[model samples]
Target chain A: MSTSLYPLASLPQIEKTPSREDGIPDGLEEELRAYGCKLIHEAGILLKQNQVAVATAQILFQRFWFVTSMKQFGIGDIGMGALYLASKLEECPIRIRDLINIYDLLLQRKAHIRAQAMASRLASTSAHPRTEFKYTPMSYFGNTFYELKDALVVAEMQILKRLGFNLTVVLPYNTLVNYLRVLGLTSREDVCTKAWGYLNDALQTPVYALYSVPTIVCAAILLTTRHLGIGLPSAPENCWWELFDAEWEDLWNVCGYIMRLYRERTSEDHTRVMGMVAKKGVRQWLEEHRPAGGEGH
Target chain B: MSDSAGPSTPSRKRSRWDIEDEEAQLEQAQQPVKRRSKTKSAKTSPAPEQTRSSAAVEPQRTTAVYKRPPHSIFVPPRTLHPPLMPSRSVYCYERLNSIEEGSYGVVFRARDKETGDIVALKKLKLDEEKNGFPITALREINSLMVCKHENVVGIREVVVGDTLTQVFIVMDFIEHDLKTLLTTMPAPFLQSEIKTLMMQLLSAVAHCHERWILHRDLKTSNLLMNNRGTIKVADFGLARRYGDPVGVGGLTQLVVTLWYRAPEILLGGSTYSTAIDMWSVGCIFAELLLKEPLFQAKGEIELLSMIFKLLGPPTTHSWPDYHTLPLAKSITLPPPQPPQLRQKFQYITAAGIDLMSRLLTYDPEMRISAVDALKHPYFSESPLPKHPDLFSSFPSAAAGEKRRKPYESPPAPVRAADYNLLTDFDP
Candidate 1:
């Protein structure tokens, strides 16, 4: 009932990674999660959702994957479902048709980029002219569009059911703003903007699900101040993070996660992961891990 | 620990001590029932063999059958997990009767088949929603979860039916709604009883406000009183979190019921806050004294006129930001006159009148907050608020109990004119 019901220390996913139990490699699991969260962010932008709605969607997606696994559920379907559900939770309702079209467009865009990357690599190797790729939008009357729509609805219910219908997600943006004002840093536009940017970037990882709002906000502030070389009031036993109830270790840990997100070779990881999944084909991979009843279809 | 769920469990299942403990740990606070604690203990100490045996003997007694793994999403393909225990099917409860229908949902009195506990099941209306789920219902559930207090109605769980459209919100069933109680009673609540009810209402409102939630709709109908005399604030469909930006389009103008609506909302103020809920509380206070809605106007214009007549026209001194409202310029101000609050409630004490006036102040900034209202002298006067336990119980109309006619009372008057004539004749 309380927002702090699942503290950072007590979350089941934080306690034990579910993907690992499903035989997924640790590094690959982390990339898949980051990619899934990135998909939510991109889908949110395509759907023209507000930051809170987008953040809520990202957190829901992360929370869903924490309990479930990529082996069983498709990230694209669940990510779209998270956004669709978050739009409703945050009182910003996105129509099913618009959601489906935008998601389709996003997936196509990703495929197009991958195709371009492959074409460039092949051209460089064989000294052949790179091929041009023209993208076509999904048709309203197409079977694929209708099928995607059905998948979205089913995925939404699955997400809701899996998450136990606890749809209220407390995002750190509000906390960041509040903390900034309290720390007398609101006037510093650079610090405020940087902290906010850190929050947006932090969403790429599982920080939102694993860390409390105050901890995340404090981490953002710490990261922002360090980046800008801004001095904050710090005396023995009166540390600023301590005032916000953020532990010293947690603040640094969140910062480390955000930094790792930047240092990771995301494109290379994405290529390898996609190639790994591609060997079996996405459909066949999903089919192999599908639960007996095909409940989420 | 098994003793907690033993033979005595049926009667002593939801003891007050359990509720107090649940409330003490607000973060993990769930229903007063013993299922959660039982599950928690079962998880830590593996007594599953005994639990399974008990489950076999008394299938309905053990809620362990409903438990799924804490983190697994596909324990059985499509089942839910801990905390959101697979929402038991709606068929788990037997419908007693329809309670009432609201714009957002329909209420029904139902009995839990397993526990035989009575609960109020609110079936959200999803058929007309073009949007996947109504934001109002989401806000209601969110607010209810956030603002959990004894004075606030406790939401047990959400149960689903055969189809998604048949979602039902299970809440602790109270015996009577204040509106029905007032209409049926021969006499209005005594001053002490009214004070007690107001205190309970104010406490609930204060609890919600402290959590940054606004119960935008507060009226007599939304107040439920149990046989024990405890009153709980209910119907949070119009409730939402405030203090943050209301988003791009701004908050909706339509919220509280017409009779209980605040002046700012009626005058097209888009950026209202907790003050609006305070205004509704003030109206409810007056309704308790008068045994009817304070403002029974048919439309916005008429409601505004009624408000102006009762509180006098809003002056520059009373409301500094009156001219800033969108619809402020459309109205012609009446000649200034003093508030007729004392004239309306002729028997109310000076302290009560002062408290009522503060709550009904024209300026939102000047309106009394629930926290401040709780410390007001009105509650400390002679004939102080009665304890909830001491308050007399009435026949529960919700349970279909017919009200006994008032002793030696004349036949009910058919209309206002007849009532007025009878009063005049008696005088």
Candidate 2:
């Protein structure tokens, strides 16, 4: 069973797959062009920086695809649907109207792809004015309580099988919250918020399934404290140390990618940076040394 | 109360029995008044069928035809008793007896007093703490209600319990399931006996597939047989109802028992269709003929490898979407293994081998369905078992009698770990 599961080193990098409207296959380049793959990559980086938000967003994305695909509903609705489902599946459930508003924000004419025109045409036919996409009561989507029940049970069984059924999966949020209270780390409020959010996002990635929830929470706390330049704990527990060492490199990579995206925006004039991203494509502009913006990677 | 009729007159006798004799007398009385009635109105009149229905002797007379359904088709009650509380609204002749524990649910021998017939009452325990009745059960009942066949378990009533605690179902009971029968057989069923069982299994499944129902769980244990050796497929706990292909439906990962699970399911593909069920049918066929389970994988990954070892690795040619599955390209699978037909199952006949190959096709579109498999050569030649009509009926067996065996259980698989996924595979 373990052999079938992909290890982190073995996982294939997420690449854009060729897709078409019906059954026809389109070229990868054309598909990428149509989807604004460049912009999505930037968003992924920005999300990775704020790990919690990224995890939440990804959860939304996967759940949306899962639910819609299961119901035999259209895949075209997945982008918005993912967020809608994710918001609930994640701790923060967003309102449908607000999510549609976010869809309008995220999908405004960008480096590539213009879904606004298509969206407006679809929206006109929608019975609800508030919602950008027409809504159907796929009670099965809400009926996820059953599926989740199964998945959670499976998850426990999986954890037991992998660890020889010994380790207990202590819930992360409670322990993290408790630790935060004890440490009195609430002084740097913005840092705390960002760290908490990043930690939440880690769950959306497959990495969550790799280790116990407590290990993740501990790593999140350590990363947050380190970024703040606070004195580390004198005597770190062996379990905490083990998680920190194993994940530090991966976490650093994620944090660096996120930090670069944010610093690029904050360093330059807000309007100017936005314009540069609009023109060069966020991915091209953020590259270490590509004559500011270029066609090729 | 037509007591004024004269004795010895044909009119009197006819008038006493039917309305025909009185029709003429009534017409004679109304003829004189017809001229006035005609002047009054002629705008609206009832249709012939409606008139005949109205003039029928009694509404109860027509209901008798419906009381006993024809041999070919049977309609179980649609609005069953509510789960749990054992509602008397749905008729049950007998009280709850000791439970007959199966792999999935608790079964009991029950009786129906109205017809003096006994039934097997299966109490399905749904985890209400987690959710409501499992979707598998929902799909099974939804499809089974519409399915009318003698080879399938006749769902007498779906009694919805008041709350989570008390839900139960009352169904027609047979004395023995196939697993019990297999124990009594001297050895593995002869090729002919195997053919008869497969035919019955296929007939039931074909009926289900025609109605867009997928029996996700299909194994020997789920198959029940009467003393006369007629097999009826039971246990719809893992069944699913799909109206169209690629519809947004639930991911049924834990569909079949690990030994009988298909490779596609093991790949973590959330939504493989009826082809998954056919794979289990193939497994059952091989098991019956070989007298042993096939491709026993202790865990999910190992289970997958075992399947690959037997059937060979699925290529784009075999399963077109093999590469595109979400989890397909993730793992770096070893070089593809060739199909090892002879090494694993050396004893099965060549005809059996052909049938197994057809039914176990990796490509769902290419896989032979139950109905098509029935037309296979395995059932074409040699001695076919007696059909339903010729088979002797046992009053006690069909009426749900208790033929207790000294508690024999299925051999538990020796595995490295128990990775029980909560999807509806009971074993």
Candidate 3:
């Protein structure tokens, strides 16, 4: 028998972020990633995907950017591809048709929101804070629809290749719940809800790829308890994080990243980042590099 | 001075600018330049520019190896180099012959071009894929990685073809599957040989369960054997990780082949664990002994009848939750009768009977686990398991070897009377 490739000890490591090397401006990579993760979350909800699948898709999207540049690939195509692949991995498969339609719908909704924001700024209206927007689904038989479909297929393979077929992602949500139960903190509604929110927010960052599941879980719990002003045993001899193989340094690092995610959320505008990176979308790039008679059909 | 200067003038000019341009182009071709060193050496004597450029590029290539951060949690300490490279193309291996096509994928016996090593390649069926990549393939790959053991088949790597539909999984090629071995062998395996095969199978199953994976489909055909007596468990297409809550929709009922399926599954049980795999292991155990499948019935009803005949009807004592099953209300229970295990295998030792009976128990909770079965006294009894290396080898049918003919026997005698001869003799 051949030696095992992906022993727990030797799983693929978090790669160096190539966005800076590819000349993407500082802080923009994080904005693009957050935008991409949001795309996965909204599309996942629209398609009725479970939390695990959505979380897995978010991690895949973050990991893809670790080796690839946002300038080279569009966030929408890669985000859709990640969701499509994650659903399969989690055993809750969504048809590609449904996936494409929902993804296009979400993109249109974002565009509508952005257009309204632009129109309101132009009209200089401060009275009307909210405007009702109705969504019109894209035509299934249009060229744009087929182009997106082809881009989705190509993006799936591109993500698979860029990630080196290491599709197994161990999520920390289950670990967090189990740890809470072990600590006899399941009944603490505030702590559970806060920790759950922290875990969801952590997906928008690179913490999922950078740290182990236990460390992430510990960070979430630690941050939640501190924020709620609830105390847990932290004495050196009986510290809780050590039981889950989480060091103090790693836990703090994870907590800091998660905190930064909330602190920096105010500056990122979706329309500006989308305009900056979506100049040569993944679909256009695919069409330019597409072989004359490829097998995608 | 003029003779030497005239010959060297153009050459010196070429080396100044042209060599630098060539070096720039070579640097953009990220693959290491070692492959072109031989051609470079062959032409370097004629052109000094070629020699100078080759020397300059060598040192730059060597420094290109990536270094991980000191405190990086992603890179494991033991691996000096991780497989960050893209998957190799499927063309790297030449297809020797087609192996059996399964529900999830089609397998082929292939030879690696560089290594000349024979490997089994399973090409996933993506042509009819409507939901993107299939979950079965994902589960199979994930479980195989998590449950790596000496007794389990090793997955080499995943390679891809030109199109999206052409992903292939490379695995170690084994000589025979136990099902074909049983039918083709001249005689049934001796007790000692059976013990060795069983021990290996149990070890593999125990390894999988230890890692929280369930090989939902376990049959003789999925058990691969080498020329030596070692058996490696293969075919994890139906395998999956099982844990608390058993995922969103719960476990599916459409798993494990009908003949090897556990009773609870046939009775519409949705939540199952390692017990289901243990039941399949029991079916495989029976097949190994009988030299055929234990329950060869055509349908689920007939299979249940066969199982009832061998292990007796399920009573409250045997299966406490039998009536709680979804299908329990529709089907009526058979009349109570004793198990026919002793009658079926009268020659087996007491310890052997005990182990088999424990494996084929009516209640899944009562079924012996793979780890416990490994410690059974039957293995330590007289005529113990033969050493895998000491066992004789047979020509592999998968390699296209002809079978050896068995010795001829006398024809059966025709009887004039159809009645029982023993009763006539007594009268």
Candidate 4:
């Protein structure tokens, strides 16, 4: 009674490969996915200021793209949707408006850092609606949260459908902590922080799609150790990844996809962000099936 | 019924029952194959051609199906959701008895085929506009999976039928829910019994809160007592992780049902925490003592007034942030009323009243937590709380057989039983 919940069809495991057959053009898949991942981090940066991990949100964004291809919906719509669902799942329920407001603020901060005065002003005014301006960032976001007010709500349904309604998202963060302890890095605060960062970044990749949870945990640890020039006891004696039966190659592949994103930031946001998002019949389908706003309770 | 019958009867070349038989046959034929490789033994029939022939019959009957659902617009998905890998346990079981209709779905006492053990089968129904299964069910499933306290209702596995549309969440079968017992029990429960029940309820809430989960909907109907007198918290449709993600824009104004809703939430406080569950537990405690809801108001406003009249108006001292909360300022305060717990519930132990006041304290931070309430002298004094296994007065508990009032009403209609009684999970 508190929230609208519509049961949907269970989603099949989509092929991990990004291709035209999966909806988005080959290059478009990588570009839009990168934009989606950026949006998640932007939300993450906002959450981090408040001391909340964006792992749940990132995983949701990754899972959403996997289940529903980019061709069906735009990157921004799913990104906003992931943020909305993550807030609730993370235990701090935020309204979509708050997400939009905070995102606007973050985008403004980013623009201010780059000294882009117009973008910053537009961001600031919209983020603070009562501060004497009304230019919302809806068009910039392909009208995701702005034009489609319940886009998050609709995307939430799509997520549940794809997940077989399984909302349990196991991020590598928790398992990474255990793995960190096993590798004697718990005392090395700086090294552990580096690992945690990698783990957060890994959340945005297809790591979860490619391997199990502990395996990703190993990959994050591996990336952290390699980046920092840390050494580990070889093989048989302290073969930690083997403890979880995780293969290093599978872990490397998780690292590969994430490492590719480091170069994706320079891509044009407009090409990836703007596009038709509400899957063809989704709006009319929404109009017909959308539950009334106020619940009986 | 006639309007649908007239048009569909002529359109359907076969009788309705005939279509149903075909559907059942289809289920039986595909059951093993649906399992893919796991149930190789069940897939003795290599009749792929026969399977296709029967599946071909499905489209016609499905098209001619009734658009009218008696109580709701229940259009099961015409295009099935793609199936994920087959789960180990598909819900292949026989329903033994109807337990009751829950907040969202119909619950049944069923026999789990593989284990040959009794379990509660919650079957979700499509809600209005035929938007598929309820997300509330998903919430409950996810919540149950994370929590493993003895006092929490545990989901065994998600059991889907041959089709993804028809599914059941297998859960531990608690013999009776508090609502059933409270409504039907013939005698006043001994104080010890009350203590035992409250202890279980509070423990469950405390455990959930510890894990950062809030059982937002905590009322009599959601508390189920097993035959051993152990009451496990059931129905997490409204429950969610409550601490970190709470920020300015994403907070939900909707919360617990009217009677059990906390003052802070009712007063428009959006950042309500686990204290809300304590407020509900307080209401449930009052119900156990008084045999009715503590504040059964006609609406939210009335409920607020009733609470204020009972506990006194919210003051800066009582609720430090009272004036600061947006909702508290929305309405003018009614004339002050003195606290009346002693006058109203005099029959309850003074210690019990002491606990009640603490549980319902206006200041959420100042309110008694489940952990603290469990340690209250009320539970320790006089008749010490009975071990759940030894205590039994809750309807489904074995001892209940000696004193439980038999519900004379025939089995209530399943879906249309009481919409208000329905919670979430299934649409």
| lDDT by residue (tens digit), candidate 1, B367-396 | 999999999999999889998899888999
Clashing residue pair totals per candidate (backbone < 3 A)? 0, 27, 0, 13
Q: Against the correct fold, how does model 2 do in TM-score?
A: 0.44
Off by over 4 Å in 1: A1-23, A46-48, A92-98, A118-128, A131-133, A140-147, A173-198, A214-260, A263-268, A272-283, A286-297, B1-88, B91-94, B113-116, B244-248, B403-427
List model 2 lDDT by residue over B1-427, tens digit each.
Answer: 1232212223322333243434445434433332332222221223322322232233233333422211111211111111111133234446546546765577777678788776787766665433223434444554566565778888776553444344456677776666555655545676666788888889888888776677777888788877666888888877755645443434657678788777777777876777777888998888786676766568987877677767787887888988867778765666777777767667666777788999878877798878789888868766664455454333343344545565978667644235454333565
CAPRI-style quality class for the chain A–B interface of candidate 3: incorrect
What does candidate 4's lDDT look like per residue over B142-173, in tens digits?
A: 78866768889888777666544556778887
Report interface Cα RMSD per prediction.
15.4, 32.2, 14.6, 18.7
Recovered fraction of real interface contacts per model: 0.09, 0.00, 0.17, 0.08
Q: So what's the TM-score on candidate 1? A: 0.75
Off by over 4 Å in 4: A1-165, A173-197, A200-218, A230-297, B1-91, B96-103, B127-135, B161-167, B245-248, B330-337, B393-427
lDDT of each: 0.76, 0.50, 0.75, 0.64
Lowest lDDT 10-mer window, candidate 2 chain A?
A1-10
Worst 10 residues of 2 chain B by lDDT: B75-84
Report clash pairs, candidate 3.
Answer: none
DockQ comparisons of all candidates to the true complex:
0.08, 0.01, 0.10, 0.05
